[model samples]
Target: MADSTPLLSDSESDKPPEPKRPPRSLDETIERCIGGFGWLQIFQAILVSLAWVFDAQQTFISVFTDAEPSWHCADESVCSSFSNICQLPKGSWSWDWPAHTSIISEWGHQCSTSFITGLPASSFFMGCLVGGLVLATLADSTLGRKNMLLFSCLTMSLSSIFTVFSPNIWIYSALRFMNGFGRATVGTCALVLSTELVGKRWRGQVGVIGFFCFTLGFLSLPVMAYVNRSSSWRTLYLWISVPTILYCILVHFLIPESPRWLFVKGRKEEAVTTLKGLAQTASALTMSFSNVLIEQESLDDNVDIYSSIRILLNKRWAAHRLTAVMVTGFGIGMVYYGMPLGLGNLSVNLYLGVTLNALSELPASLITFFLIGKINRKDSILGFTILSGVCSVLCVVMGRVWPSLQIAMELISFFSACTAFNMTLIYTLELFPTCVRNSALSMVRQALVFGGVFSPLLVAAGRKNNLISFGVFGMAIGICGLPLIGLPETKGGVICDTMDEEEHRQTEKGSAAIPTLA
Candidate 1:
């Protein structure tokens, strides 16, 4: 009516675009960051979080079982009491006997069950080791995140059920291993799913929030252990299993397939429909509806399976890879496995100590979230690594000087290690392009497993010379931090979608007159 085309052109040319502002309301910010997931997704995230709690509960029930009372008959009672009470010559023991002797002694004799319980725990991690590399890669290819998550949950639930019915330690361990295989799929897929849903501005926050859920799982373990302490280990296993099975069913129905993965696989209509549904759910107002067209670009369908491997071997990536592996491997290996074992040695309240250790993760997550946006990635990583290393050294020195301080030292060490571990995960995710993100993450996961394997040996060796193991662990953390000087800072940078973009950024940085490591 009023020269609309000319007015629009003139207005567009004259007005400058508004600068992106930080969100004022936390809820609005989170919604903006998470995009389109809505209340159902939050509920799903909670369910997934609880599933992880059960996962840890299943593994940690052993510690409570190990410390439970057992029944044992005295030699005199064995000779006198025969039949149901006690069998003298046959060496058979029953539940009934003298109050103190039967409950405490006989129960103590069955303490080997606790050790046997640990076999499944180890097997679960081993399963994670295998599944992370094998099943996680499928997140990008054949299986989308939703399907993979459902499969993992289903298998893990089945394994948990089987574990509850396990006739012996071997069956329990095998089922736990199977469960671990499924558990391995959860973290990676959850990560990919969260990242795909969000825009670039909020990827880090979403990643950290996902890890926060994991930390919640860790924190909840001690509560479960404390509640189930008086119950039979089998009962404890059953308690943990039921919730996970229910969660699996919920996930199967409620969670949708990742639209990005659908797009990648050339399921354009499905992806478009899914996006539309998400928009409807979020009540998102500013979506570019006209731009909803599915544009297919030429993708490298023939990409080498070993492509990530080659990149990791390259000079630029190799250094970061080695640093990430060594630091993360050591940090997670110590923080997760070492804390419980160390607490067991100190005769401290294992559940309390573990809970405290897990609770420390909240602050760590907060620290990373605050600092990741402001500071350089390399500095944040290096700073945390040094902090952990210093704590490790303190653990050694303090453990020798005052045995009472061992508990305190363990707490400090756990906090430091967890902070470093969280940083390493974020840094590793930041280092790679989207095309090979899963593969690169898998490589780092492999390093974590490798570290896990060595952790037991280190703990065993520490039994002989406690100071030595702590010292070695501390030194490793400090040394690993040093190489970070060479690593590039990725804070505030657009996440690279391809290797070419990454290489171009590197070239541009290299050509700049000013040195840019900071």
Candidate 2:
């Protein structure tokens, strides 16, 4: 035994010295540096969240621009105002509004097929889908969140400028596609960057800031469109696009890169500098970043832009979590995006109905903002989705008898959806670690947008039958939440910074037989 002791000691010494574990983890260190959600952090988070305002503007702008205008009988003897515009002779009816007020009136597509009318909206969504697939990993790999966000807003605004000059519907549709492509990364980047800039304690609330800004944007459109009711759709585009260009410039100069992202990318010096700039006190800035080493696996700056996505797919647990969240997001998105667009089906005035729905988002965002720390992500998603679906279905059932009740039900449905949408995004952020958080969130957003791709068609079809759009929205959100049962609850769990760290946590939890909260 005495002779063998030397060999054991030698073997122990031969093993590489375990990297000195920091007294505090990177998350804890970051939390310490940010000084418990300082005002500076709040200001930055709100600044980034403002991007959602423009995003929401671009998103729902078509609701007004492509609207089917109110038509009047040019010759009342031949046709009434209620006459089917498609069946009437060209000179028999004319638009009540100016020809340039809406694309439908401007381009003489008032009587065009639904396919033609919905084409631009659908093309826009397709651009979002393709753009998400292509740009999802760029934020995680090369550009970082701020740069990617800046690029997206720049592209979106520039394309909108070009859209002002579109001579035909085809050109307008193509430009709308470019706008969607550029806008695809805006919400995701903003959400991730805003949340990442703050401590975990404030992440949920910070994330909801974007939702509030989005509601503001949604509300702004009705006002903008109404004020410009007699003006050309091109003017509305200019109003939205020009300010967005100025916003991109502000973002470029004002926003800093996410420190967490920098740390993951092996840029410690920059990460430290960012944290220092964000720190409210000189003492907090004094904490040494030297010991805040990332896991060896995460330090590989040579990782390809697509590596984060591949990692998500290759890992069975991540794949399952991703699949479940994405499936659930698809349902929430269908109602969230579809409801407002389908509001034209309600008996309320289009602008009033849209304004009411947009207003509903305010309460939804507020609820999430206040209860974020206490809300259970899975339960909230499930409950709100179920409620949204029931109300949507009830809208179809009760709409014919009481239009007021139908709009109320629609508002309730949208409110629930907005809350669920907020939670879904926050939930997605919690499920993944820093290394792949952007990619995972991007994929989930793609799922959301993918659902929206079908919304215009459903809204168009619902023009004739209420059951198609509202009913489908009800069924999809209600049923899609079941897969969440298989995913682990992320509430109160510290977010990890690397894939290996996350996997280790899962393994330890599994070994300890920890039960997940519903």
Give the alpha-carbon lDDT of every model: 0.59, 0.87
Candidate 2 local lDDT, residue 471: 97
- Tens-place lDDT per residue, model 2, 396-511, is 98888776688888889999999999999999999998989999999999999999988888888888899999999999999998788777777888888877777767776882
Local distance difference test, candidate 2: 0.87
Error of 2 at 388 (Å): 0.6
- TM-score per model over all chains: 0.76, 0.93
What RMSD does each model have against the real structure?
8.4, 3.5
Where model 1 places Cα greater than 4 Å from the true spot, the runs are 1-55, 58-61, 65-119, 280-327, 509-518
For model 2, the run of ten residues with the poorest summed lDDT: 509-518
Q: Distance from true position, residue 413, model 2, in Å?
A: 0.9
Residue clash pairs of candidate 1: 70-106, 70-107, 70-108, 71-105, 71-106, 71-107, 72-105, 72-106
